[model samples]
Target: MSRLMRISIPTIRVVPQITPGPPPPTVAEAVERVVAFLAPGNVAVLTGAGVSTDSGIRAYRGVEGRYLNPNFKPMFYNDLIEDSPRGHSFRQRYWARSFIGYPRILATRPNPTHAALATLMRTSHVSQLITQNVDGLHHDALRTKDPELHSRILELHGTLHKVHCRAHHTVLRDEYQMQLALLNPYWAELEESFRRTGNKPRTNPDGDVELEGVSFDDFEVPACPECQREGKVEMVMKPEVVFFGETISQQVKDRSYEVIEQADRLLIIGTTLATYSAFRLAKHALELSRPVLLLNLGPTRADGLPQLEKMVVSSGPVLQEAARQLASSRLSEDANLREVLEGGIVTSIEDV
Candidate 1:
């Protein structure tokens, strides 16, 4: 009943770094293993989409990640910055999917993974957190508990809750929400239909959805209002988060280094260090003699790196149990969460 784009294209798949087969062998007693590594305070936690999986969001890469889906093709930064103009709107294909996806993101709450990290931060168990996620769940989780926790966290890819003008470099201080619904009345109607039919589009880790056969012809994409008034740009507004082909700002890159330098160890939670943006931080942390500990479900780019002190693989938010143990042991004299060097690999006291 509403104006609609009539184009239909077959789905495409973007191949991620394929595995050679087999995930990292698990170290038994995963919780104790994690707590052993977490003994050293000033630990810097690097999180990824995996951490937020319990919150109903899926990770982009993992044993069962979207990146591994042969039918999935992520929208790159180049695609967003240089797609069909007008209704395409720097590719409102991106926005169109986001239009269907953002509601779940806005409705999501921090899960146990968040609570674990928050507990670490509040008790000074860790000094800082550098997250590759742009979901802002970390901020949401720690905001009330420790008002200053947001200050100690560095979002490498930025966040989706804010908007910006690609041409004007202007930040739209508003809930990611406005432009899509406001510009495309028809798209909004389609979204409502999806909800009503319980056929809501499938969403990805980054909050972009898969609108299999949807067209973008009549979708009215919004341009940077300020830029449009100044005779620049044609309907392209971007979420603040870094898209696939985008680069993290140098200032952010520098601050990330500063944050990394503040900690003697890097504990990567729920990430594969797949992208250079996320991998580089772990690489940098290693180059400076910082020991890296990987806690993820499958193989990571950093799996066999010599700089890593240890690695643990699990399908779920394994750290929740570890955090609970750490919290419970805070006052118990029977706490034996320290790592003991036996013959070679680090072992917990319970090993003996």
Candidate 2:
């Protein structure tokens, strides 16, 4: 666990030049301007669920609506460890769904936004990407394509594809098999029920599942491996993900702050900066007098902040264009592709 440290600084107001005189700028042009604003070395990127929406994932909240399941609510970390009946039941249904749904999620492909960010990293325009998304799409993108410049990504919300024991803290890459066999022996049957009824279980952005009529008594929660060594083989429980009531470990929070502290400029995309746990870091950046560029469809809580440089647009094209421009300047292959894909010299709405 890392200790908490605060950097005290006053906020400075920066008004970003909003283009309104001409036709709307294409995604590539928007990105070019954003890229030009960022200097080399230690730039920070904060991404949200909107970045993954183009890849088939849905945003939980938006200007038009908030997507939520009426039947399921998130289970907090304290609730699970305290052995609440609802928590146990929730975990059972969650793991049950993971058995059926994990593969479908894994099969999802990265969208233009992800590819663009990867390209930016390759071209040395970005230093670190701090994402609120748990889908692991950024990681997937990196694995598929080896970028020229290495950029580190920090997952603030925790990854969906990982499970860890609360007691021993041993992380599991694919615990669906182990959890299914141990926690809910009848999961297979229940999953069939879901399939037959065409009632797909609802999950939050964090990937926690919700189901009705399930009881904890009918399931077995697994025990920690270390605890089991002492004659207690309890069912090890994997909750949907970090829930609302849970606190992101101090270590994770501190590391995120470190990145904010070192950042010269902050690029915020796809997030509304709604959650305090996630929003506080952006607030910290504002305190340090760092410039923040926001790219999202809806309004953000941080939008009202005096120092935020905001752009109301979809991130998919914005990032793609930015990547294209940065890559073209440095890599010959990227230059050729940029010309073909963009159809001549890319121009911003500001330029037009």
Candidate 3:
């Protein structure tokens, strides 16, 4: 449990300027500030669903600050573990929708924000990148673009690419989805048809699609293979993600705090910080007196904190510009250092 309390501070809201002027900073100025903020490096980034929204994933809350799907409620942790028909039904609905949505999730490519972050991570500008999304886009971005620096990212919410049993037995989500396709061939074919027609279902931030006109009760749920080998009868596999009412693992919490402690500043991007886990990180950074910057599209839970600076702007463009400027600056610095080294070498040889 985080014991940190929020410190009140005056809010400085800077909406991106279309015309570069004085009343509000231009987008270029905002980019410069972001670059300067990252100049010292050791920036710990805490991202949310907003980061992946550009990749075609929809956030829970929209720009109007309301739930996009008012009728949709996420499956709770307790409900998933309950040994009842409801639990079975929940699993059926979850897997059925996930079966249809998995392809889209798999097909999603990282957007500009991810690309910018990858550059920063590769250059050591980011100390740690913690994401609240289970989409695994950050992992994808880093793995493909900056493979060696992939370890810098910590998926705060467990990823959708994994499934786990109550016994903690884990398996790749792709393998489990394959099992689902085999068991529910009808839905599998339907998903393919949907893809062919270019009418895919709306996907939630968690990677489950909003499916309709289907009987989930008839959907077959796959059991944990490890548990089944042990003679377990009931199917009890769940996505390896933090559900609505679940507590995050202690290991992840500790690791997040460790990075925040080492970071000189905290830059929260693409999230409203609606969840406590994400909110506490900002609070933790403030507790440590580390400067915090929110580069989000809208109001966050930590809006009025004294140590925090809120920049309400589109994350993609600002981040891209910042990364470009930082990379250029780094290259210039390296060139200058090399020049100095060469000059020193020539001087030493002449003296010899």
Best by lDDT: 3
Shift in Å, residue 306, candidate 3? 1.4
Model 1 Cα lDDT, one tens digit per residue, 1-352: 2211111113332224444544455544667667777777889989987787777776665464336455767666766776455325546677778888887676677766676676667667779998888788888766454457678888888888777776546654344356668878787788788777767566776777877776766666676777767788745667887876576777777887887888988889888666666777788889999878887766676766776854446524456566656666552432221210001121121111
TM-scores, each model vs. reference:
0.79, 0.77, 0.86
Those runs of model 2 whose alpha carbons end farther than 4 Å from true positions after fitting are 1-29, 39-41, 65-72, 84-87, 144-151, 176-186, 189-203, 210-217, 229-231, 333-352
Off by over 4 Å in 3: 1-24, 143-148, 329-352
The parts of candidate 1 lying over 4 Å away from their true place are: 1-28, 64-66, 83-90, 143-147, 167-176, 226-234, 315-317, 329-352
Evaluation by TM-score, superior candidate among 1 and 2: 1
Determine the backbone clash count of candidate 1: 4
TM-score ranking, high to low: 3, 1, 2
Q: For residues 1-352, write the lDDT of model 3, one tens digit per residue.
A: 6432221212222222232212435789889899989989999999988887777777777654456677766777777777799988888888898889888878777777887787687677887899988888777665444455667888887899999988899999999989999999999899899888877677777777877687898999988898888888647888888887777777888888888998999999988777777888898899999999888766667777677888878788788778777787565666532222122110111111
RMSD of each: 10.2, 7.9, 10.9
Q: Residue 223 lDDT in model 2?
A: 59
- Compute the lDDT for candidate 2: 0.63
List lDDT for all candidates, in order. 0.67, 0.63, 0.76
- Compose the digit string of candidate 2's lDDT tens values, residues 47-118: 988887776665676543243333334445555555666666666555555665554455466677777776
Best by TM-score: 3
